[model samples]
Target: MGKLKKIETEIEGVYIIEPTIFGDERGFFFESYNKRDFQEIGILDEFVQDNHSKSRKGVLRGLHFQTEHSQGKLIRVIKGGVLDIAVDLRKDSATFGKSIKVELTEENRRMLYIPKNFAHGFLTITEEAECLYKCNDYYYPEYESGIIWNDSELNIDWELKKYNLKKEDLIFSEKDKRHQSFKEYKKAGGER
Candidate 1:
């Protein structure tokens, strides 16, 4: 198992990392992240918070980020799989208003690094999915906020066309529904 590839995007501080996997009759193993290797690849974040979530299929978790104490995240799935998404919300970024989506699964051993000032979300693709992430800052409830996952302005192709998503299955908090869209959020100086 070795470092397979690093995909740097137009969005600053965003990356997709694919690690080499070695399998045998027993099982498979891979190095998820090595601090030295991360530094070499220019991912110099020192994560201080770790979060894990489990969700059933059709469960959608966000378009969430912090307005005050924003977090940069290194996200991946440990079991099953999900369609992970990151939307650029940084008002000053070149990629502002753009979004990137990727599939993450145990088999792929891939991870996404999302820098601060972006909204993060995922949709469970398997019967069940276990997602984990390392965050550069501790979560602050007061500062936590989100945009509607289906917001038209951002125009994220969640690729949910194949999945049978029910109204109940597309779960969200009341707050998420009311959160500002990119255009509105930007006009209100939502960027940090």
Candidate 2:
């Protein structure tokens, strides 16, 4: 349990998890997500699904969530790195419409826990990146929906140029490109 440190983000339920690493001439080792360590921080929900994804530089994959069965995700990068992002959507919360971003890399071995009711997404920062995550709920595409990534109202400040990538350099699915705006989400009554 002592091997993990959980740091709260400005957003109420988001957390940055750092694990103590033991390294030597050979390599390094650490418990990526120990149940005991997680329990110590009051994250008691059991993860029901594990997901993995690989993306090339300039690939951006979300701002998505399930409207009916929202998922809480614990995300980490293994092969390279990414700018992981989460946006709060709880209408009654102070941080609603706010966001938090973190750089998750192989070297840092850090992870982000994004609770339900937030949009989750990431941009691959290296030539390629491999991401793994545990989810508290299984995916249900029928209930899937998203807020558009570059909504003016959210003012996400993705800092795309800092990574030497421009908006045109990014790759997005037509579905993601057409996601609703934050304003639309609000008009629709937010989070079914």
Model 2 vs. true fold: TM = 0.97
Model 2 residue pairs with clashes: none
Q: Candidate 2, overall lDDT? A: 0.91
Q: Give the poorly placed runs of model 2, Cα more than 4 Å off.
A: none
10 residues in a row with least lDDT, candidate 2: 1-10
Top candidate when judged by lDDT against the true structure: 2
lDDT of each: 0.83, 0.91
* Clashing residue pairs, backbone N/CA/C < 3 A, model 1: none
Q: What are the candidates' C-alpha RMSDs?
A: 2.0, 1.2
Q: How far is candidate 2 from the true structure (C-alpha RMSD, Å)?
A: 1.2
For residue 12, what is the lDDT in candidate 1?
Answer: 71
List the candidate 1 regions with Cα displacement exceeding 4 Å.
1-4, 166-168
List model 1 lDDT by residue over 1-192, tens digit each.
Answer: 366478987677789988778889999888777777778788888989889999888888888999998899999899999999999987787888899998999777799999888999988888888989999899999888787788788888877766666556666557766776777677768842
